[model samples]
Target: MRFFALVAASVMLLAVAAAAAEYNVVDYGARPGGRADDSAEAFLAAWAAACNDSSSPVMRVPAGTFLVSQAYFKGPCRSAAGVVLAVDGVVVAPSAVDSSAWIMFHYAHGLKIRGGTLDGNGHAYWACKSKTTPGRRCPHGTTTLDISQSRGVSVRRLTLVNSKNAHMAIFDCTDVTLRGVKMLAPRDSPNTDGVHVQLSTDVRILSATIRTGDDCVSLGPGTSDVVIRNIKCGPGHGISIGSLGGEAGEAPVRNVTVEAAELTGTQNGLRIKTWGKPHPGLVESVTFAGVTMRGVQNPIVFDQSYCPGRGNVNCPGKSSGVKISDVKFTDIQGTSATPVAVRFDCSSTNPCTGIMLNNVNLTYNGKQAKSFCKNAHVRLLPRVAPRRATAYRPALPCQLESRPEIRLVGLRLPVLCLPVLRLPVLCSCYACPSRASPSARDRAGDPTAGPAPPSRSPHLLVYTHMLVIYFQDILGCGKFKKLGLQNEEALQKCFGDIISVGNDHWSPHMVHGAAAASPSNAPNVDGNDTQDIDIDLTQDKATCEEGDTNEVEQISPVNANGKRPPRPAPPKAKKQKSGTALTIQEAVTSMATSATSYASTKQGKYSIDEVMEHVIACGATYETNEHFIASELFVKKEQREMFMTFRNNEVRFSWLTRKYMAKYGN
Candidate 1:
């Protein structure tokens, strides 16, 4: 038994030693010291041996210069544990290699590449494409390192210089980390991006230094949840989010953050660009914070109509359809190489919105910089050093304008145009009435002639009653009922008279008769009860007769005997305790509840259009241009929070208005 046990122990120890194996390139016939002989085969042989190990394996390249050409490492290795490529030497790519990438790793899992220098020998390739070098067809230069279709990958302390194209590319990958990496190339190198990330997520780049001609870091379509911190970039186009929308059906880019970056003498500090073509993609929830720019040109930009070549030759003139929103630039202090420090050249068809700037200070040649904007909705918080252009204004709340006149219950009151509904509303509190004295025709032997308009003083209650009748009869009370505004008694108490007319017509004689019958039920205005006043119908009748000819049909509430008819009985009021004014939170809650209830009737979902309808029904008032209602809502903290929370829990309704969805939707 002792002899058998000793033999089993020896076998187990040998198996363990075989599992943790190391394969050296020199042992596999790799010639070092920058040999003319191709070393790609030796490196591949070493990788194949190491990858076949069932446990942790390391493939080492010893301390010497080696020459390789177009090496490809493909894997789903036998090892369940990780595979490591440890290089203590320099790898040089031969000149004139006709491949897309100098080195590529595809379908590799749990791969770690540590400590190496890769030289791409791109000087001849660059010179061949120069204008001075005539009649020379340039071969498509290769990227230095390309990793695709892999996960759990990390590259540390790697130095890549003079790549023909992009230095390093992370494509269709996840959970990737590139730290302590350095990429260097000439400032005039064509199309040599330092790092490019495309169709990837959960990518982190920390403590990287890049100097190149193209973008230091470029994020392509379908890239999200990326965090880039402590980057030192110069002599290149700075970080960019696109050149997207080049094709239809492209995915959106979202949730990206570039923080603690120092950009010196770059072409642009931060930029987002899209082609002038049709695409349904969108960008949102991105932040660029704590960035310091030194003499950067165009420190901030959003160019939706991007055309890459010189003079924008052969570029399409159509507007871009990619929507961009919810982007913030905070604590960005910079010096601009040009006078215009910030520019927003957004698409006219799909305007950029919900952009916020906080504590951004940019100077142009030691003076306050200038800004330019077109088709963008920007919110400038306090401490913005250079104010926006005169043509642009900070996004403000929506303002209901009084441009049309509405005839309600024989009173011609100015109507407010509700932006959400695009319809005229007869509410009295939203707009000041035309207080001009009654016309000569109205004053000619009219007993109802008075200095105060129907929207003010003793007649305000009557005007409000007219509004309730208009809403109930003309606008369909069932719709308003769903919004929690169909409570006749509550609306009356909140505004004026509590009158419910079942039909589409109201008469001044009915109001006078009701006041005459029940004096205590009348509203009190200016220290006097409305019941004590003698209401007249002559001016009301004349005003209605002389109103616009295109008004909606109205039925008179007068009998054939020229006498006022009795008012119809109002709806039975619900028995509820009276409450004090609501706090902001309570108001928002009430609005959300009403919106949810209304949405349930539609399809178990709600949108900004539906919400805005409810807001109008609840008598919410704002102040701004009519085109900015959705933007204003997103700018207000309480409303945005409520909407975001509501959207997260419920199914989103996609049939919202295009304008609202483009600016505020996810």
Candidate 2:
């Protein structure tokens, strides 16, 4: 019995020794700076022994250059903590890659890999140009590191360079954290994306510096809850949300945030692209904030009609139906190399909505930034893309600057609750002259009833109009000139140019006779102030009526007495419920939807004065001359009355704006 007990004790000691083993690759016959296949076999042996150990085993590779062929470390380890691979050496791939990944780990959990230099030796493969031709169909050179079907994985402080394809590909992973990693490749290298994530969740990549030809970080299908912060990307495609929906059975991507990134000399700063074909999944709740760009081609973009293949050039596929919404861009300041700093070419079939641009200031060639928007509903928040037209800033929700307690509601059109006022108010209004109430002008008396006063500055009004005209051309309004105008055409063009112009059709200025029609005689025109015109919603739809001649022209010509005609009586106001009366801003709240909802509705066809009326009624103030130039709404109350003094009152945007007025008006 004593002999049997002694034998059992010996066996227990041996098991404990195996559990606590630390297998160094050098001791396992891995020769540093040796042949590829041999070194790989040695690494495999070390990993196999370490993975079987009962305790948390560690495999170490000391400093040296080790040539390793296509290798994989698989896990379902006996140890609770799995394995820790500490590599201080330089790992080199052979001149020709033999497999899809130079170093791969599969089905691993509780795995940690730290401190290593992965040299892909990609120059040799680039010379041979594998996968460069049609006949070479196979995936040529392998990605530097590939981790598949892994969880609880962490890779820290690794330097990877010259990858044949992507530097790292993480697939089907969760709870993955990569920190302080650096990746580099030639700026022109093809397909060498820095870190690619697909079908992954709960992934965090922080403090990464990537300089590559492709996207610094590319999120593929089924990636969600991913955060990428404090990244520096240059000489590459900055960060991309997809090339999604290429296939029929792809998944959705959501809840991705990219913050504090600096992108310099890159093709794109922040982009989301999908195939032009119909994609069923959605891409939503993606936010890109606090990004700085220098010399970037397209700082912010969304391209749903992406078709890059040669065959697709002529066909360009169909409109992509990937439901993309609730995307916000905040504090993205930069200088763009191209004039088109922002291009939102969304799919017509699934028009993008709930898009917000907040405090995004981008410039091109020392000029204010330019944007081309199509088929998308976007809210230009306060201080958005401040360029040549600074007026866009004041049009945003007033609460953003003054009232902190007020919260904004609605994504396409921002509505906010004012602390001083209880009801919600729309933030975006041109705050132009048309919004001035007819009663307000009537109380001030007529400017044309007497000779022009010495204090009244018609010259300032003319200069302001000229400035507004100049800005219209700068803001993609070339089509306005092509519209043929006759008498009072110049004034008609000025008053309606900001709004009421169709995409191609132009509105002619309303003039009684040919006297005030010419652009040169603009200063002598009867209506120089925008508020002089009362916006009458009850008028006939057409600008001209059959020979009534009494139909008030937009700018009525001066009579032989040098006096202007009286404006028609305005509609009566509805009585409010017994209590506090609603302010004019609260009454005209719906104008926010009509004026700012440029995505679905074409508000440009509404008269500038009409849109301005709603904006002004909404409590937005045209406090500066620059504001007047941008909105075509003079700030001075007297000036506004002067501009509208000689015209008929027609509310062009009333079809939509009046609905809100009826609901909220006092």
Candidate 3:
């Protein structure tokens, strides 16, 4: 009987509490001609007074343009169950008296600013310049809307427009959501980023349309668990991450996701900006899925020199000693400005890792694809491109602008004309230029054609849904000659050869010493050749004397697995061959182009017997002239001859030689 009574009492109390939790509606104007000013400040004050009162109703801003200067939401903003600040009205700033911002929210929880237009009324201040750091009493109409130091806040279906400064500045807030918000700024408006989210966590920005002067969205340091999804961005600096130089020793940005966005006419598509060297702050574990881009310049970019003010002598951007790691980009197809489709600049001291790309396909307007990361593990699924960039500058728009952000390759808008190259052509707008750029000739010229294929250049920025992506090309400083390729060829192969995963079996060998030539690459061809060799490697240095040759001899032509490696050269026989008279690279290239392709030639009619006789005859000739290897090594003559004769086809001969060599001491 006691338990039953207790349960009944508890149930009754809960029911009463639920019933008492109801919405209150506070209407500003009830008295005729006593209309309440619908300014942002006025609404905020009225809303605050009523929000805490248990008897206070949900404040409603009626459908009128209320001129508001600045309004702050300082309370906990714990909605009274069914109560919401429903603004089916327009809140405009005052016409004359300076206003800092239209709306500001701080230290609030469980709040939603929905269905409202916060207009800066900015015919007054869009063109005025603002410094990187504003003074204490900033001029009126500077920051349009700033929400800082808040949590569990949701601002949806709002149109925020025409601010002199940033359209929306969100700082140090967590668990915030911005859905269906349209942020609009002028194409040339200075410093007017659509949304700048800094040092925030667990934030979701979805289905927003932003056209701004600066980045559509700038994700600054210490941002974590952020998701920017399904957005339309154009006429902006695209999406940006980490101009990071100021904040070191802070928790880095991590676990960010950008997905399903369409972008056009933006300065870039995907970008990751760091300073010279890297900072202690890191950017890791980011993803870009299902992003479509059109007519964006330098769709990919990474600028390390973040803060280069007027007299920045050390302009390559400071290396903050930070590492960018474990990033992925998938399903991004678009038009980009430069030859580099994807470029990454991890500090050589603290390099990045775990970069993967599966089903990566991109088509451009005949510009080189400078895609791939240096000194990192990059996995590229099999690529199917009909054409490749044979050269870079003649194909890309690299250095056309004088941007302060060094370590970033700057691309210019509206290419003039591409001077007969192998890649796509586009009007560039990205700024990814080196500090020591000599001439503007690096900027590619315009060409009349459908957007060409992506270039093979391994160093340019890439963007997707407002996320910076590319470990594909960790391109910074490198000696092309040491890599066994000319500048352009090295750039292409540098992107093509990186391993595609973590430091696993397929990863590149990381050494303080130089990298070795890969067997999979094409042979060394003449730089001035009409037909290219398939190999991608830097040129080997000259062997001066016996000492050099001895050192070279110690290094065998085999990988770690000890596979039968392709000989770089046949030491003695090739010297006497007709090819020896030409340059070494020409000889190698001639051999490569002459090799049989699957489609070009037919299977031989000769049988196994004929091949056996040929092998025997070659062995006898080698034995007569050579002292090192003999006929015995050719496979036990009679058994090899008998077995090889009848099975002279390539497969049969190959298997017999392998089987004989395994059994005998050949």
Candidate 4:
């Protein structure tokens, strides 16, 4: 029995030794000289040797910044099926090289490059490219990290700085996982994108901090099943779907999801780009959910305008012809630059269809964003509302200051909220002259009315009108030219231009036959503001409507009045309610939904006091008290949990909802 015990103890020691994986740990400290001064190719060579030797163990480099012009990670890097090539030391490389990249991993699988820093020291490369002329190949356009044709590879917690082209590239690879990675390039740096993925599949990028001059993550054709979550992006061309197949792009990109990402100060939050040179295949099934943005330009943009400034002919499929379909954008809340937060540009003929947008909240600068589309069918759950118009910052350094121009056509209108007024209204009246424009001789006094101080020559009643693009002058009439309200002909002309008059049969803006007959509500022969005009709901159903427009016209011509009413501070209701018990205001709060519940909260009684009080009072705690006991409440397990869940979103997303509240359809 004693002999058996000794043998068992020996077996235990051997098992422990086998479980602990380690490298051979060979030392390759080079003496500072011609071949070794700036090169650590020898150390890499040693590491490779150790990895290949069945007997040699894991190889590691000591603390040092090893300079390498171009390092090729070729061969079967035997990282045992699931092991990693963990680097703790810094690897320095020339920012640009003639042929290869600083660190290139080719045909390797199941690899992980983490826990290290890579520097592309490119001072010489930058200088060499600057003093050259046009048509010359620049030298500073090399990649920092390059991986191609590998599967199940991951790069996490890695910092890549000052790269020449795209900092990191995952090419023709599958299952590329990038997490906690930081990619940086100065704001003015040229062609320096954070990470560019090409011809890859099942790529997952999460919790990455990126600031770059170009696209943060350019999905260059041949990428699908890509999932990006929890990304912080600034000063870059926010996450993109394509620069797709230039010469030979990959197959169609499908099944993409981006969630819980913040894109502050980005160019485009969610974008779908097509290749200029036409290729086959399509991009479909893309979704952007729970994304937050701040001051980003064109938060949702589908840019088919591939006109290059350098005199390239506009080509649909000839240059690059690709169509995108089956896209969904849900729960996107934030502020954008352009009024049209959600803009879609599709083919004039075979335009995109079936776009589903739900719970999208967007504000522009401080105003309501314009939601618009062309040649596409978009279904927004709640009507797109506008808060106000605000200022926007331009990208690509504008030579002239200008506001973006917006055009709307062929839109499937969403439902709008309308307020109900009390019928028993007290009547108030204002006196006005009969003539819109009095003769020059009549301006002399109302001789018959007798010494009435010339009756003030007919007060003109210059009130501002949002539709028909009308502006107001103090003389009780509009500034006709600026407001586009000069005359009946002008009003007709403006109507014709704003809405496509050519498609009069299909167009919603055409005036009814009654406008020419009743003429009372319509503008007079001379372009003048008509009083007591009723908004033709049928005519204005697809657009914004003014309270007094008798005929169909552009809804409200929004203008930014000074000193906007301060948004009501979030109610300090310490009540902890979950998802199930959301306030009606919170549920149907979209501007497009017509905010009827605004006046629900009342004095002496709660707005929802009677309706919700009994349920909440009996089931759960409505008021929040730090010392409140959870066990005291006898509500159902599911109901209590649901209330808590909803309440949490309201508080956390308070700022976000406020930003996007006004920009529903805009």
Considering every candidate listed, which one attains the maximal lDDT? 1
1-666: candidate 2 lDDT, tens digit per residue: 999999999999878775457788988888886554358888989999988987878888889988887677876677878789888998888867754467877667888888989988888666555345654433354678887667899989999999876788787678999999999999877667899887789999999999997789988777899999999999898899887765445668999999999999988889898778875768999999999999998888787877653456522456886878999998888798876677777886887888887777788788655565556656654442223232222111121111112122221211121110111112221111111122212212432232212221223322344224221211112332333222235433322312211111001111011011122422334566454766775465444444456766587778989898878876787876543345555556767766677632432233446445634443333762223332532333322432232212211111112212111110
TM-score order, best first, reads 2, 1, 4, 3
Tens digits of per-residue lDDT, candidate 3, 489-597, equal 5444434442222100000000011111222322345664457567433333333444565774544566889885765764554445365556887867777776744
lDDT by residue (tens digit), candidate 1, 1-666: 999999999999988786458788999988899649789999989888887877788889889989997677767688876689988999999887754567878667889999989998889878875656555577655678888667889999999999877788786678999999999999988767888887789999999999997789988777899999999999898999886775555668999999999999998889998877766679999999999999998789887876544555535565888999999998888798876677777887887878877777788778666565556656554442232222112211121211235455568754321111111121222222222443322332354444323334324533655444332222222334344433544433422321211111000000000001112432355466434665579987788767846587555578999887766766897765445434665888999999987766443233455455434422233432222444454333334333332111111111112113222210
Worst 10 residues of 2 by lDDT: 505-514
Q: Rate the local accuracy (lDDT) of all candidates.
A: 0.65, 0.63, 0.53, 0.52
Number of colliding residue pairs in model 4: 49
RMSD of each: 34.5, 35.3, 35.4, 35.4
Best by TM-score: 2
TM-score (all chains, Cα) for each model: 0.57, 0.58, 0.53, 0.54
Which regions in candidate 3 have their CA more than 4 angstroms from the true location? 1-41, 54-57, 78-83, 95-101, 130-141, 314-317, 366-368, 372-376, 383-666
State candidate 1's TM-score. Answer: 0.57
Query: Lowest summed-lDDT stretch of 10 residues in model 4?
Result: 503-512
